[model samples]
Target: MVKSNDSMKKNNILSKVLIGAAVIVGMIIFTIYQYNTAKAWSNRIYPGVKIENQDLSGKTKGEAKSIIEKKYKVGIIKKKLNIKTDARNYTLDFSKINPKYDIDGAINQAFNYGKDRNLLKKYQLIKLSSTKKFDLKLVYDDKPVNEFIDSIEKEVNKAPVDATLNISQGNIKVVPEKKGETLQKDKLKKELSSKINGEIDHDIDIKAPMQAVNAKITGDKISSINYKIGEFSTEYGSISSPERENNIVLATKSINGKILMPGDIFSFNDIVGERTAERGYEAAPIIVGDKVDSGLGGGICQVSSTLYNAVIRANIKSVERTHHSLPSHYVKLGMDATVDYGNLDYKFKNTLKYPIYIEGDASGGVVLFNVYSNNSLAGTVTELSSNVYQTVEPNIKYQDDATLPEGKTEVEKPFSTGYKVKVTKTTTQDGKLISRETITDDYYEPVEGIIKRGIKKPETTPVIPPAVPAATPPTPSAQPSTTPSAPKN
Candidate 1:
């Protein structure tokens, strides 16, 4: 019995020793595996990693980057981005923008997976990755992509038009506003870039991206210029000179039916353009240097002068003006505004709050100009007065004439007087004076006629002291005279 009991005890001790040895071996193997795994993951992507379903397990970052780039990277020079607008397909070349996938970033993300987690979490990640691979997210520069989308906007965009006011066929009218369209650039770029970078490769059907832009000046804004504000007229002989009348007609046509917005400048020269022979300007009589001369645009000054008076009455400010060298018969002395193509011009500004229009006409022996606006100065009466402040008399001179007979006198030109005049403008409303101002101080030159008289013979002849007659060939001789005349100083 004692021997059997000792045998059972020895058997039990052997079993315990074997169990401890097995536990120690298991621990050593586990330590070696953890060390190997940590070392392997230091420079390589985690197991079961993928980029767009392409596995990158057990590969270094560089190798994974190469693999992904080779599979997904496309030649930008050959790629094209398709844009569609109302059934029109536009192929935009990708070379200019230089689009490419960000392979390095995707690979780096895959390499870092399961590395920053705790031991247990790392195990869980690995376990999860076994069933479903971890996808490396893709990224790219959006600047070039966005700019490409912007380039398409020019071809597809249409700008809106504002309503306008003008005269048509001698009647005031309002032009309606026009609608416009634009491409949906911002929204299109987002969707297009996503499809291009997505893992699934396929052609995308892009619907036409369009939007509406409203006009700033609506129908209500067109009503501001509906009424006449102020006007004046001057008379002209229509039948005397056909070309002069034609010029007046042409200039009036150029100025008539025009709109001047608030604070806008009306340039007669700029609007009428150069008055050349090619522009249908005929050679007619015009004033230059105090004389009537033939020039390209003759009687257009009559139109301008008439418009000037109308502008003054309308209370519009003149920007630039120069009077004729001599007083004009068409308009008042201080009221005429003449324009020389390159040297001089006439301009006025629309000082009213609302826009104004010009109505000009020359017909039936009369030339007329009228300024119209919504803010009518109908009850305002405009009156003009002129006062001769200084008068200059003519000077007379005489000259000897060799061609005319002796003691015969002839007049070359008639005498003329010069005068300086002051022009004043007075405005009255409701029988009460509103404003009184001096408009202009003008001076006219005087010209005197020239007279020439002829000299027939000498007044007296000098005689020599009684001397013997010189011997000469035989001829009838007279007695010598001894009277000598005094010389005039």
Candidate 2:
């Protein structure tokens, strides 16, 4: 029984040894197979490795990069992206953006697919790559793309246009406003990126995104001015100088066709700008420091005065107004509004609910201003009047003149009477008085009469006694009888 048991044990041990040797032989064969496979693919991509779905199997790093360049980089350079807009279509070439692929990175990844793993893991991955397919990442610079999009934006964007009014003679025309359009840059960029990164085998078409822009001043807002609310006219016939008349005409033209919305303040200085020779303003008569002198933009004050009266009649509020140092010849004593650039400005605000328009005309010795507004103010009437409260007599001034003969006199400047006056504005509707308000109390300075009297003495003529005959010797003896008889004293 013991020998039989030992025999069974010996046979079992021999069976175990044979099984262990077979296992060792199988491991050695598997290691040799793995090593051979890894060595074969040491410089080549795996069978299932791809870049953007383009198979790079069995290709070396240089060969893989060449394949990707021919398939993607070359194709990208030849491909174009069509951008559609409302106005037109723009085509952008991929070459402009200098498209590039990460050829090195993709090739390295494919080549190193199974290199970092153990024999079993490497075999499993090498086998799995056939069906699992490893894909490489794509990288490119987006700066050029952004620059192209910016150019597109500049070409597509438009500024909105506001409505305006044009008045000629008595006719009025309304120019309609126009809406604008802007490109949607962010949305367009995303769309382009998606398409550019997805494929490059064919030309692309992308619709540029856009948004609408609204105009600020619509036609309806400017059409509210349909009636003449107030008007005033001043005669420039007394101003004989052509330069002064030219200045008046230029200034009136500057103020013509001006529109003022509710609560808008109109600045005479801002509208007329600085009066200079470059602006076509001639030297004319202007009031400077209590003296009338020739200066640039001299006669524009008449236009300002005329417009001021019209504004007052329209019931508009004056924000800034100044009176001349001396009474103006065209307007009443207290009704003039004088403006000097950078120093004095005549400003008024539109107080009505609707917009107002100013129409000015200076022609044929007449300077006129017409204020137009809503038709609701048609029946309203405004009357302006000035009352003189005190009159100041001018003093006479004498000056010596050496050029004139003695007792001669010449008037340098004529005397002008000064007055303190009160200006009042009266408003009435349908012959019924609505309101009466005192506008201003102004005082005009008196101008002294300058008279030049002659201080030079007159030239005297020399008076000569009749030529006395040369004393001759007494006629002989007649003179010789000297010491005759002396008359009794």
Candidate 3:
């Protein structure tokens, strides 16, 4: 009985195993079907893709591929619109797994990339300033250009974009164009412009340098030469600033008869006109050959002295000039230039390549002089202090004009100034004394007159002894001895 039951159990176990096997086969078939279906759906959903632009809304992969395949039959070109900015190669990654990877979007992106790659330039959209040039002109007279020039330089440095642009064929960056570089016809057609705006802010002529010019006298002191104002020179001071007009004449002459060539130097004494009332000179105190006297436009030397400085600051060479005998009170010592008519004079030659314009003025008792040039000079000029030499003179005897008092009644002691000085000129070139000249300044010494108050003393006669006239000296004292009796009678 145990054997039979065991056999039945075995059969039942075998049957169960067979049923399990059949179920496993059925499951395998179902799995195969599902896998094939999924694969067919994947192929249908995303077919051969074509990319034209970046944006794709409803286009399917198969349709996009058809359109691309037909249109791209001629072999698609690798376009590089901006080689420098944008890369030349396509950026799509096929291995990239994205559920929303649209064929149309990819096609659009590829087209944009290719278009940029095909161009010769890496950048575009340049502004007007990059291609524009600003023209400039020198309208005003030559003067100090420090401030305005600096401003112009600053503007140039602050330029936003470089004027030159580099471009070439087939996505290659070419060499940038330069000012004188050879360019293609199309490149030349693309005009580059730069604009600069500026004006004559301040008139260069209006700014008078007022430098100290070296004055030297080549003539002798005792040769009977005199310092005199020369002919007057006229010039316009300013057009805008009429109040700042400078129409005053220089105190001396520097150029005469001969026309000054370019680069000629000028001297004050040589150009000074004869200073006389007849020449429309206002009477002004002047140093006359070592003497103090009144002369025409006596104050005009202030203009000469002022010009003397302007020339020095300009760094021009001084040909000749004569200084005052004694240091002048108007200008500092070692900074005075004196002019004499006919004989004593000051002169200087221009030593520059360009012509220099001199502007002089003497309005309202003030003299202003200026020099204008295009460039700064190479050499420099510095002025040394002037020394005063007082020579002791022999006391001059003069018949006192009783009318003049010995001294002013207000002051206790009379002023006694007795000295003479010849305006001496010490000329130097490259720091070596080239020449020495003496200009005489004859200052008259006032003679002190002896004065006594005119008054009458009380009438007191000189004491005279009373005379006794009784006997007229009794007949000769000699007879008194021999004729005693006669004397008694």
- Please name the candidate that would achieve the greatest TM-score relative to the true structure: 2
Alpha carbon deviation, residue 488, candidate 1 (Å): 64
TM-score of each: 0.52, 0.63, 0.30
Q: Candidate 3: count the clashes.
A: 87
Model 3 residue runs over 4 Å out of place are 1-261, 265-272, 275-279, 378-383, 387-489
Clashing pairs in 2: none
Instruction: Go through the candidates in order and give each one's C-alpha lDDT.
Output: 0.74, 0.85, 0.39
Q: Which candidate do you rate higher for TM-score, 2 or 3?
A: 2
Q: Candidate 1's residue-wise lDDT over 1-489, tens digit each?
A: 367978989999999888888888887786566666666566877678787778888798889878877777763345556778884687756555555666777777788887887654565555456633544343555677666567678777889986665665647778888888998876887778566655535444566579999986665654666655556676667434887877877788888766677888999998887888888888899987746789988888877888888888877768998788767776766778889888889999988887776777777767777777674566767777878888877676678888777899888655566777777888888679999998788877766657888876646879888979988887655975477888999
> In candidate 3, what are the lDDT values of residues 139-250, reduced to their tens digit?
2211222333333233322212212112123121212222221112222112211101112121111111112222121112112211111122222233212212211343
Clash number for each model: 3, 0, 87
Q: Write the per-residue lDDT of candidate 2 for residues 32-76, one digit (tens) a residue.
A: 998888777777777777777788778888888888777876676
